[model samples]
Target: MTRKTLILIAAGGSALLMLGALGFQYIGQMPPCKLCYWQRYPHIAAIAIGLVALWLPGRLLPGAGALAALTTAGIGFYHTGVERKWWLGPESCSSQPITGLSTDDLLSQIMTAPVVRCDEPPFVLLGLSMASWNVVASMLLALIWLQALRKS
Candidate 1:
């Protein structure tokens, strides 16, 4: 495929993923957790890089796109781990220490905490959570970006 075609596939994939996430949020009524939001920033960056790379002639932007994809994929993997209890997630969205807090302080913390928790998978398909799917999709997009880099 041409460089432009590869770039389109890579960047368009990110767009589609974002749309899916939004659909899950609005249509499906599934709210994203803190890690879910973290996974999105790199996809947004990839989309912008892809748009600019379409007009430029260099491997830099394509490489940047690949890096963005990889970054998101890594976050997705981390999120998956959090959901699976393989490792701890951020204290803000996951479990936090309550050892030193008084009853009132604990109540305040609980009240102020986010409604969504990162360690719980709100939706899963084929035994994989949305974060798992993002990792898979982002890795594929990264491959496409790498192919575009080769063409450049």
Candidate 2:
């Protein structure tokens, strides 16, 4: 495919994922946790990078887009591991505990705890949670970005 077509595809793919995330949150009633939100940032960045690449002659934008994809892929992997109980997630989200807390600290923790957590898998499909799907999809995006770079 041409570089322009590739950029458009990459941007459109990210847009679709963003819209899907919104649909999940608003229509499907699945509130995103902290890590889930983190995974989205790269996609948003990639969409912008793709747009810029469309107007530029250099390959830097596609490379940047690849980096964005990779960053989100890493987040997705971390989130998947957290959801699968393979590792601890963020202190605010995971149930790893805020150890050695005093009475006041415990009260603060209770009051400030997030309603949704990064470690909990709110939805799953074919034994894979949303995070896992994100990892797979984001990696695919990285491949697409690489192809765009090659073409450029």
In model 2, the Cα lDDT at residue 98 comes to 65
Output the number of the lDDT-best candidate: 1
- Give the distance in Å from residue 99's predicted Cα in candidate 2 to where it truly belongs: 26
**Maximum-TM-score candidate:** 1
Candidate 1's residue-wise lDDT over 3-81, tens digit each? 9999999999999999999999999888788899999999999999999999999999999999999999999999999
What's the TM-score of each model vs. the native?
0.87, 0.85
Superposition TM-score, candidate 1 onto the true structure: 0.87
63-146: candidate 2 lDDT, tens digit per residue: 999899899999999999988889988887534456899999998888886589887788889988988988888888888889
With a 3 Å backbone cut-off (N, CA, C), the pairs that clash in candidate 1 are: none
Which ranges in model 1 have alpha carbons more than 4 Å from their true place?
Answer: 94-114
